[model samples]
Target: MLQINDLTFDAWGRRFFDHASVSVPPGAKVGLVGRNGVGKSTLFKLILGELPAGDGEIGYPKQARLASVDQEHPATPVPLLDTVLAADVERDRLLAALETAEPEQMGEIYARLSEIGADRAPSRAAEILSGLGFRQDDLARPMAEFSGGWRMRVALAAALFAEPDILLLDEPTNYLDLEGALWLESRLKKYPHTAVVISHDREILNNSCDHILHLIDGKLTLYPGGYDAFERQREEKAKVQEATRAKVEAQRAHLQSFVDRFRAKASKATQAQSRLKMLARLPPVSAVAIEHTTPFVLPSPDRPLAPPLVRLEGVTTGYDGVPILKGMNLRLDLDDRIGLLGVNGAGKSTFAKLVAGALPAMTGHLARSARLKVGWFHQHQIEALDPDDTPLDIIRREMPEASEAARRSRLAQYGLGAAKVETRVENLSGGERARLLLNLVAAEAPHLLILDEPTNHLDIDSRRALLDALNDYQGAVILITHDRSLMELVADRLWLAADGTIKPFEGDMDDYARFVVERAKQAGKAPTQIRAAEPDPPPKPAPARAKVPTGPARRRAEAAEAALARASQALADIDRALTDPGVFAENPAKAADLGRRREAAQAALEAAELEWLEAVEAYEAMKG
Candidate 1:
């Protein structure tokens, strides 16, 4: 579906891609991976024509549509669902033309619309938005009402709804919560078109993609299967190369010894010269470079704390006397590893703050051991650092009693080398700042650590390093992150933030994934029922067709219901406007217009009812 031939790109005094060639087959989900600053995004820019490559060609089908979510969707007055529906440019164009097209042109447009299933666009867009963490009410909310992060999700939803031939997503889960991430993973696994995602979330790369594309040293290598398969194949290939290089080196050394011994004598001059030619003809084998990932330093607590480090009984907390989390009863022990899961704005961070003593409970009892020490690391901590301050300066303030050497040593332990010690916070990479803050927060070895969305800025390897450090640290941990792999590896138990309270979630990540997808499916059904003002009775669960219900049949049923609701609402709106006496008495043209619209809407409503009945029958057949 896409091809790059002999691509060479150079910028800022360095080459990003050197003779890199790769072909992505149609419908392949490819995960693009590399270390930080390896030009993965630069390659995307080249493909998008934002950057001109110094050499070679990037090609795809001429008519193919390419879509990417490079930035947040524009904040406009348009409703969320309308914004997403408009992403299907072909559908929008056909609909616009339908309003004025001549009679002869109507047949072709209608046929094309049917072929593309334009009638189902609303529910499809809603499903995408719901899967990305938007609520049923959010569909009608203006785009301008959402924050930047939610707007980013809207851009993603639009791209997914458009179903472009080539979909490019870069770190899509960065703005997502755990539930949204899980839903996206499920969605991408079923995406029909070609998708190339740049992500550091190991689980997404391993589960959502069928292929892995590794970019290293200005070269691209495509591997079959997921990330684990890529790692194994790369290791085997390296072993073979290293073995071959060793054999060639031994052969060269023997030839050189023969040349050295015989070069000084005429008897063997001809043979020595022949050996020199052989040595020169040997293929050069570059030695494999050992890659090193900097380790995170999280010191173990000096002393262990007693069990029940913290306990909350019916704890209610919020800002300005408005409760965000209510009736929360929970306990943390000295060695518990708890993974906190929720959607954004579900009060996970607020819970963390309450435990960290940054917020007081509005009501109910909170108890903690008087000697308990807690280390809190949150996403905002990195942003809170002063731009002009250096690591050395920060460490000096943090470790005032320590000598200059001790302060520098502490910074090094946090992965900041001497060169970075004096570097300003603004100059430091995100991973560096994260590393410094993470280590600094835990430097004193507190008995408990509350880390919230800690891996957002860290790359895959660095995330693994932090995971290792967390596992090694002898303290109770409360972890919140969108990275599923990190959560599974680090947390022993799961807690869910839902319905204005925290409670123990009774399942593993796989079960939680199913719940997320199923919840989105339910959310997709809610908006139509709300607008119709007559909710459908809930269908009884069919044990034999549990899996099939969440697939296409449920979506089609929801889409049909949405179409019906829209038709009914349009008819109702026309009738309501016609009820105004001024329209008939003061403006005859407006009255005629409303009458014509009402007729069309009535016909549309009848057609929608029949479609909804057929969809329901089809879905019921699937249940059977």
Candidate 2:
């Protein structure tokens, strides 16, 4: 349990918290939500003792193991799985002591290891990694081998493996794909220990949190139940406060008017003085802190958008001829709203960059309209800005031909206040920086907009604003986001960026959401269990024949084939049980159990086939 008593924290000459008190009971899954720059992250740091309290008392169990996602890893040639498993410091300490322990202490160390389940650390680490969308081969892969996004996953896996008494998760969904995020939400729901998560994802907040802690205007409010309940309760509280404020204001006004009218008259001088005293003694009505509600306004393209703004025919794109997306056939017609979906490292970002023309296509033909204008909001695009430059400077530099009014007008729509327009970009909060970057793209007035993880740093309200703007805009949009609500609301069509290709998803958002969850579950299952789900075939080639695996790669192909054969045999045995009426009659319960197990087994087989197909495709492509 954690108790925060009469907390008062001040920074930048402004009070962030004033005599705020809150308690987190044991095993409470609390979602700490607030607008960006509200000091939610700062509170986490204070709880972790990374920062000294400004003026408050914070108490928690002394033995509590505090854990949060590590943003950085030391430069070491350690396997990803090994690095994660090593987070269990106690396990490592016990193992180290076992090597040189005294005779009497040897039994004690062994008993401690058994108590902590240290021997199963590797398996436990693997399960966490699998849930986070790591493949079997990734377990042995060095941390240096993965991309930045994958390394972030490694960091997340390490945090989970630590298995702390209190887990502090800040924007945990940012590094995850839809599948990984869904898996993490499920994992947190089952987590026995306490967790306080800071996320802009409403789905995660509503599903995983048992309580909601809102930090509003120098005060803290803890409400029981999930985010939805918190919203309802907060609204009710606001309404009650509004009525009380109105009554107080009316009484204060009457008293002041009486004093003003009679204070100068000698006949009622004493009474007027009394009225003045009463007016002074009346407490001011507490005003609700007005939220900064800034709607994102995107300017329409200057000219009419031609149909099919961009087309890629049999496109193979990659860096240095190493293909990430191959034989991609895609077209973006006017007003096409396509939501890009896939696991991390599945080339969603790569495809976006290719379409944005940031990368040159390695093969196949590409066509663009003569008047094509492209607007892009790539992940972390805010970092691309000059840190020393302000929003005003950035807008002016990007649109030099525009008048001053135009530049300021564009910035204002993004909620960049007059004072903040000239503040150093480096000094801006993550959400503020996000808005500036968005403004940069919006000002371009492009017919096609490609946004990759645009809602990463945005709060729920900002996301809603962006979605509303996008929905009303008459332009083609290729949006890549893990925010399901944003995707479901803005995208009319869905595109799956996986299996070395980009293709239309023939399902609704709900179906895609279910697929993401199912895929995550399959990630945790045995290989023999997921073979029934079909892996999308790579785009068709002109010759209509795929290259076959050969040479050293053939060994891997053969091994996969053998393993799949074994999985198939396991399925056959289950089928035999399904057909055995004599066994059912003898033990009906046993038959029902067998039937259920067979279904899971079939799902596992489907997943295995998908993996096998991807392997074969990659190997064949390498040979070619």
Deviating ranges (above 4 Å) for candidate 2: 100-115, 144-149, 257-281, 302-306, 513-624
Candidate 2 weakest lDDT stretch, 10 residues: 543-552
Predicted structure 2, TM vs. truth = 0.78
Query: Against the correct fold, how does model 1 do in TM-score?
Result: 0.84
- lDDT by residue for model 1 (1-624), tens: 999999999999999999999999999999999888889899999999999777899999999999999999999999988999999999999999999999999999999999999988887887888899887777888999999999999999999999999999998998999889999999999999999999999999999999999999999999999989998998998988898899899999999999999998999999999999999999988776566788988888888777789999999999999999999999998868899988888899999999999999999999998999999999898888999999999999998899999898888778788889999999998888888888888988899999998888788889989988886787889999999998887777788887789987756677678778887776666555434332222233344433332224544687789899999999999999998998889999989988998999999999999999998999888766
In model 2, the Cα lDDT at residue 230 comes to 90
- In model 2, the Cα lDDT at residue 310 comes to 84
For model 2, residues 365-464, the per-residue Cα lDDT tens digits are 9888988888899765777777899989988888799999988887887789788989998899878898778867876678888888888889987887
Give the distance in Å from residue 454's predicted Cα in candidate 1 to where it truly belongs. 0.9
Predicted structure with the largest TM-score when compared to the true one: 1
What's the TM-score of each model vs. the native? 0.84, 0.78
* Residue pairs with clashing backbones, model 1: none
